[model samples]
Target: MITVKAPGKLYIAGEYAVVETGYPSIIVALDQFVTVEISRSKSYGSIVSKQYRDDSVLWRRQGDQMILDNRDNTFNYIISAIRLTEQYAQSLGRPMELYDLKVNSDLDSPNGKKYGLGSSAAVTVATVKALCQFYQLPLTKSQLFKLAAIAHLDVQGNGSLGDIAASVYGGWIAYRSFDRNWLIAARNQQTLTQLVNQPWPHLKITQLTPPKNLQLIIGWTGSPASTSHLVDKVAIQKSRQHQVYAQFLQDSKNCLEGLIRGFKDGSLDAIKAGIKKNREILQGLADFTHVPIETPTLKKMCDIAVEHTAAAKSSGAGGGDCGIVIIDKHTNVDSMIERWKQNGITRLSLRVHPVIDLNKE
Candidate 1:
């Protein structure tokens, strides 16, 4: 049996704008993870998840579509990971084998409430990592990220895939999204192996070293959100509000670049200021698009953090889910937590997962 774990990610800065190619975002890998365990099976391959109550699902591919053999529609990203990873493995002349893939997760609360910790991305990365190890494929981190991103895009069909970078790289990262149009065009014309080896335009992933005093805190609103729905709504409105959307992209890029500088210089103040500006930029987006990027509860969470001498904002698509707080290590967050508790926010205890050698996984 081979087991691999991929850490979940939280977007520190830059949200909607990061979807554009070459836009930058700062993301951190949370200690929470989705673990995949695989073992050879003689009969038929099966996929099971302890996160859901549904029975083990058997999957089959009818042309490009993955047909689930069971009623539950879960395993969307996992199935994609398996299919794409296997395609890459076969491109290398590796034999495919049936294996029972089991998934265990710490991305949700005990009552099964998701925390918006990028569980789908984590599971996809974990599955890909496991299969690569199984096949003994000597792939670089970039190659692994490419395979996982391709798999995620095949299923999601949207988003920046920054979470996949965080999962593959771990720790703090500055990620520039690749040109999806270019990737899609290349995928159609080139073999999987050829595509994997090609340089993805505007794609860059760099590990960051945060200052010692920089502290990150997470607060869950106890309400889950659909990132795709939010992103879809924003995309629909962008055509009508092209200039505003374009300005947002520019502002977000500038803000994230400043934040990256802070990470490099170990300046907590610069980081905090950049985070505050990014929050306002997202609010502007919400106002124009009317997509409710930051809910009333999330605003309250951020307000409380600001009152406590910290910078805060909604983490992801942020209709609900979690919001992140940035504060110095010397600051006391107990009062902020108390205020959050009074306002129905639950603090998460996740920390950054340390970076490791990806090939060894």
Candidate 2:
């Protein structure tokens, strides 16, 4: 049996703007992970997930076709990963055998409330890695990211896939979004074959480690945001208000660039300024789009963080999820935690996940 664990991701910078091609976003892999186990099956393929329930889904393969029971839809990403990988292998004249899979994750509460930590992308990356290891496919990180991304996009037509890139590369990364329109069009024309061959989609992912003096703190707002819904709303508004949206994107780009430079130079003040500017731009977008991208609770969390001399902003789609705060090492952790608690924000324990070799699985 081959087991693979992939870490979840937290968006450090870049959100809605990353949806467009050529725009860069920053994300860091979280310590929380989704694990997948794969082993050869004698009769039929099956999936048992400990994170969701006690039920299992059984399936069988028939000449490149995967037939699932479809009774349990809890692990659709895993199922999709297997199916997409199978098609990819066939396109390359390399077929793989069926396997029994088990999946679980740490990105959820005991009662099943998601932490908005990119659990779906983590599972997709783990699934692809496990299957690739089991089949002895000599695929690099870039190749694995592509396959995992295809499966993720197959499930949800939205998202920048920055989360997936973080899971694969780990650490701090500056990622440019791939051309989703091109991938969709290719999928429509040649299905998975086109994606399998053209693994690189002009997407850039570069690792960037923050200075030792800076620290990252994550606080969960207890309210899950629907990224898909927000993305759709933003798309519609952008289409209607082209000039405003374009200006927002330009300002966001400059803000992120300043952030990158600040981190490289260990300039905490510049980083703080960048974070504040980015948050304002997002608020402007929220106003123009008529969407609550920044919830009152999230805004309050940022305000509190900034009061403590930290740079604060909402991560990911920003309706109501985790917010990020960057402060110096000398900052009082206890006081900040207490302050967040008093305001109904739950401080989550998270750090940048270290890079690992997926092939070891």
lDDT: which candidate is best?
1
Every model's Cα RMSD, please? 2.0, 1.8
lDDT of each: 0.91, 0.85
Tens-place lDDT per residue, model 1, 240-270, is 9889899999999999999999999999999
Angstrom error of the Cα, residue 361, model 1: value is: 3.7
> Clashing residue pairs, candidate 2?
none
Clashing pairs counted in every model: 0, 0
C-alpha TM-scores of all predictions: 0.96, 0.95
lDDT of 2 by residue, 291-318 (tens): 9988988988999988899989999998
